[model samples]
Target: MNIELHPRLAADCHRLGQVPEGLVLLQRNASLPWFLLVPATPREQLHELDPELRHAVVERWNRLAAWVARRFDCTRVNVAAIGNVVPQLHLHVVGRRHDDPLWPGVPWGQTLPARAYSEATLASFQTELASALDLTPAPR
Candidate 1:
């Protein structure tokens, strides 16, 4: 199924690939290890999804959270599905460190210097993420 990402997500993230549950996207800001899973469904909430799909998405979310924590050596991993701004059913998995810029706080609505990933770095990250999650890379 072809899933169209919300405009805000499309604008702020780089398409990484597809997992069985949905499309995986890496946040544009390279400063933090943030990822999003956009499920291929019209449902606006996680609980509203079919049982099997919901389980698959949650399982993937857990895997992504663990992977992010390990890869980024984070002290904590934050997972949330706040759809107030964007109504699409997307799950956010973020790796956070105590020393991170937004330490002791969330990464929402905070204006920090944007650090974009270099093309080479982004390519490398995409490869590593695919391998780690066994995802099908998005077509070039």
Candidate 2:
């Protein structure tokens, strides 16, 4: 299988976005510490991925959840698979907080879009997370 990420994700990849190591993308969305993980397979749908790869992705999610919980002091981690628009296989790992502006409710459709991170902040967070994750660049 090839690794064909969405155009936005591809742009993120090129920009060297701070997503978790081995888990491609890890884009920081404007909402609830949202991040997207692009598995290194040319798979558009989740079911198309082999079981092992699927398991690996899940593992990555778990690892990332831990990372988010500790880093953000989030009360919970929301991991979802909703391929409404981007059909490419990806996982959404969100850092949640009870006091978060939209706590006790779904973050989606509950608030305005995210604000882009400042250059310095984005760079620092990216580097910090990448180091903490101890990521290994996946093979193509």
Candidate 3:
């Protein structure tokens, strides 16, 4: 049950370092709109994840995807669990737009990261998602 995030994931998840129980740090390039749900389980494979956690992971991804879709007003949602590069037990829920940079193709291409949200925007999203995600106050 020894599991840790990949370096890339760790760096991307730095903002959620203070996240508390029930909330997971979803990481991605933040440019093409991607999300990875890090379940609390210490499994390196999805099958290794317990039933309860498996369900929770699914629910989390779906809910987050819905939120992103409504917020971004996207046309479709493409979600999957690609463990090819990082073998962590996590799920990806991506919001796809017909006019997005990688529209009509997978959004896995390399590119410069997007402009990070201002502190205000981050606070706003975190707060907006609080009720749905049960987000807690990040530790000071």
11-83 per-residue lDDT for model 3 (tens digits): 7653342223234554434555565666666577767777877777677777878887887788887777777
lDDT of 1 by residue, 15-69 (tens): 9889888899989998888899999999999999999999989998998998899
The 10 consecutive residues of candidate 1 with the worst lDDT sum are 121-130
In model 3, residue pairs whose N, Cα or C atoms come closer than 3 Å (at least 3 residues apart or on different chains), thus clashing, are: none
lDDT value for model 1: 0.88
lDDT of each: 0.88, 0.64, 0.62
Candidate 2 vs candidate 3, lDDT winner: 2
Worst 10 residues of 3 by lDDT: 14-23
Give residue 56's error in model 3 in angstroms.
1.9
Tell me each candidate's TM-score.
0.94, 0.73, 0.78
Q: How good is model 2 by TM-score?
A: 0.73
By TM-score, the candidates rank as: 1, 3, 2
